[model samples]
Target: MTKQEFLRRYKDENLTIGAEYMMILDKISDAPLVLGCAYDQGVWKIYKTGERDGHYIIKEYASENEAFDFFYELVLSKHNRRNN
Candidate 1:
């Protein structure tokens, strides 16, 4: 999806676009954002969103499962913040 669409869908949180990916910031305390991108290699790049050197990281993953796990971890972090 386009950055605008992503932002609109997750407007409650902060959103930013990078060179190759888009990220959705967390609404709850102490939770990192969710980062992802559509890739030319027929796979989606997903990671726990963070920045350095003014760029969002699409962390290198050995497999899709690892990337997806990070994504879920971010979600769990958010949920925990919401519940407690």
Candidate 2:
């Protein structure tokens, strides 16, 4: 997605992009947002941060787009439930 669109969609959060990685940080907690990207065993992967530690990962994904979509949907679902 375009940087402009990403910024518009996730305006509530903080985001930083690097040469090999994109880091999405939570605005309130300062925690890494969405998941993170990694290349493992000759393949690209994405992972979500675990609750225990910064290095801890809760889940992994094989496709970057699927990972991003899932994270966005999760956030939207949480928000909708909160508003209800």
lDDT of 1 by residue, 1-84 (tens): 333444454455542233343443322111243354333244445444444433344554545555455554554455456556
lDDT scores of the candidates, listed in order: 0.43, 0.46
Indicate the residue-level lDDT of 22 in model 2: 38
Clash counts per candidate, in order, are 0, 1
Q: In model 2, which residue pairs have backbone atoms overlapping below 3 Å? A: 24-33
How does candidate 2 fare on TM-score?
0.41
Model 2: which ten-residue window has the lowest total lDDT? 21-30
lDDT of 1 at 78: 55
Model 2: lDDT to the true structure? 0.46
Once fitted onto the true fold, the runs of candidate 1 whose alpha carbons sit more than 4 angstroms away are 1-44, 47-55
